[model samples]
Target: MVCLRCVMVVKEELNKLGYHYISVVLGEAEVIEDISAGQHEQLRTALLKSGLELMDDKKSILIQKIKNVIIELVHHSEDPLTVNFSEYLSQQLHYDYTYLANLFSEVQGTTIEKFLIAHKIERVKELLVYNELNLTEIAYRMHYSSVAHLSAQFKKVTGLTPSHFKQLKDKRRSMLDEM
Candidate 1:
């Protein structure tokens, strides 16, 4: 789950299955009772239908947690991270950076840095579409070293300059869930 609506869906599904959950966050749900294999399968099926998945394995859960953190950091955070990405992830997840990187690469088939960059680019797209801030402000807000760096990365990802993209009628911005 990446949004409040997704959390609501999870809650509704749990209630439909006659289960009480303590809470449902971005990537986790805390149920009041133990889940049987049957219930687990039902949940997996329900979430799959909603374009989400029930993570069973520890590694998968961890991977989802990592994704949730990145999503929150890129899309929702007001303050940029004080530390580097790897260090922040390490501190938050309580794992060494190397292990996290290797595990993420193995499971997601992409480096953590690449994943973060993708999310950052997506955020840039969102901010550009909103037109709330200029490129310099966006660079500062998103923690880009310079507007030129941000522009280069944005162009590399979207194949168009930010100014050109904003000028177009049919701007393409990806949904967070799609990413």
Candidate 2:
């Protein structure tokens, strides 16, 4: 689950099932009651019907958590991190950055850096489409060193310059989940 609507769907399904939840954050939830095996299956089925999955595997859950953290950082957070991403993820997830990076690469078949870059680029596309901030402000918000760096990364990823992309009518940005 990467969006608020996804959280609402989960909360709705849980409420219908008569389960009380403390909170339903991006990738995980905390329920007030202990869930039985039957209840687990039922919840999984309900979430599946609404296009969500109940992840069981520890590694998969960790990967999902990583994705969710990145999504939150890029899409939700107004301020960019003061520390580097490696340190930030390590602090947030309570695991070594190397281990997380390796597991992410093994399971997702891509480096964490690539995944982050893709999401960051998507966020840039979004900012451009909004037309609220200029390129320099965008660079600062997205944590790029300079406008040239942002433009180069944007062009490399999207095959178009930022100005050109903004000018085009079809301004497409990927969903958080898709990234």
Candidate 3:
């Protein structure tokens, strides 16, 4: 789960299965009661019907949590930290940065820093499409050190300078759903 709507869907599925949940966040949930195997299976089927899957393995669950945290910070949060991405991730996930970085790279086949840059570039595309924030402001909001840095990264990732990308307004920006 990476958005509020996803949380809503999960909550609705849990309720439909007669399960009580205290809260449903992006990647974690606190249920009121322990469910039996049959109920768990039913809930899993319902979630799958809604295009969601129940993650059961510990490593997979942790990876999902890491993804959720990054997604939330990059695309949803209003006031993100000014700190380094690794430090932010370490604090948010409550794990040593090195261990988390190694696990992320091993499981996802990409370094966490690269993953973050991809997500950040995607967010920059969205903001450019919206035309609400100027490049400098977008850079600041996205935690880039400067507009030049943001533009360089954007061009490197998308093969077009920010201004060039903005000029071709008809280009389709990728959706979070597709990411």
Give TM per candidate: 0.87, 0.92, 0.91
Summarize candidate 1's per-residue lDDT along 67-100 as a digit string, tens digits: 9989888888879769988899999899999998
Best by TM-score: 2
Model 3 weakest lDDT span, ten residues long: 170-179
Tens-digit lDDT track of model 3 for 1-179: 88889999999888887888898999888899998898888888899999999988998888898898888888987784877888988889899999988998999999888988999999999999899999989998888889999999999999999999987864445443356
Candidate 3 Cα misplacement greater than 4 A, ranges: 170-179
Q: Model 1, residue 129: displacement in angstroms?
A: 1.8
- Cα RMSD (angstroms) for every candidate in the order listed: 5.5, 5.6, 5.0
Candidate 2 per-residue C-alpha lDDT over 1-179 given as tens digits, one digit per residue, 9 for 90 to 100: 99999999999999999999999999898999999999999999999999999999999999999999999998888887889999999999999999999999999999999999999999999998888999999999998989999999999999999999987734344443356
Model 3, C-alpha of 81: deviation from truth (Å): 1.8
lDDT of 1 at 125: 85
Error of 3 at 178 (Å): 30
